[model samples]
Target: MKLTTKELMEIIPHRQPFLLVDTIEELEPGVRAVGHKCVTYNEPFFAGHFPGEPVMPGVLQIEALAQTGAAAILSLPENKGKTAYFGGIRQAKFRQKVVPGDVLTLEVELIKVKGPVGIGRAVAKNQKQQVTAAAELTFMIG
Candidate 1:
């Protein structure tokens, strides 16, 4: 299923400026999700990340993937209204720079889910399919 930003707000708590995902292209409950975020020069972080050569931070990329994972769980009726928090991250890798004008494609797959805690593997890639970052993330839903 696909979800718009407005419907996404009903699940995830992030708001403008902090909400990185603009839309969900696909979602499979208890499995995986694909989301998109358009990075523009007008972003607030562009000013400080660097003036001439602005690059989206690797940490933020991972966070965006995690946020998508959270949305995946929250979109499910069984997990609605739950707050997902970062639990852990492993095997994180940053392969390329993500800059303004890049359209980020976030992919997150659930690894495990036990009660309110879950583990997922996520990756962020640019439009060219160059991976910007990836990690194994654990989240607690409460």
Candidate 2:
């Protein structure tokens, strides 16, 4: 199912300036999720990341992917009201620069899950479908 930003706030405990995902294009409960983020020139990070050359921070891209993954896990009935925390990151890679006016598409799939711990494969792409970053993320449900 698709979820808007307002609906996402219910499942993901993130607020503006930090709530990177704008909407979930698809969701499979604890399996996977595809989401989006619209990058704008006004993003606070742009000012310091570079005076005139603004690039979406690689960490934020991964976090966006993680948030998408969280939506998948947290949307499950059993996980309702629970919080998902980052346990670790692995195999992270940045392939391209993400700048203003780009609509970042994020996809994350749960590859393994045991009890309150889980691992997910995630990737972020720009509007042109160019991968901006990718990584394996581990999470702890609390």
lDDT per model vs. reference: 0.91, 0.96
Per-residue accuracy of model 2 over 1-142 as CA lDDT, tens digit each: 9999999999989998899999999999999999999999999999999888999889999999999999999999999999999999999999999999999999999999999999999999888889999999999999
For model 1, state the Cα shift of residue 45 in Å.
Answer: 0.8
Candidate 2 root-mean-square deviation in Å:
0.6
TM-score of each: 0.97, 0.98
Enumerate residue pairs that collide in model 2.
Answer: none
RMSD of 1: 0.8
User: Model 1 over residues 1-142: C-alpha lDDT tens digits?
Assistant: 9999998889899988899999999998778889999999998888999889998888889889988999888887888877789999999999999999999999999989988889998999899999889999999987
True-structure lDDT of candidate 1: 0.91
Q: What is the lDDT for 94 in model 2?
A: 100
- Cand. 1 TM to true fold: 0.97
Give per-candidate clash totals.
0, 0
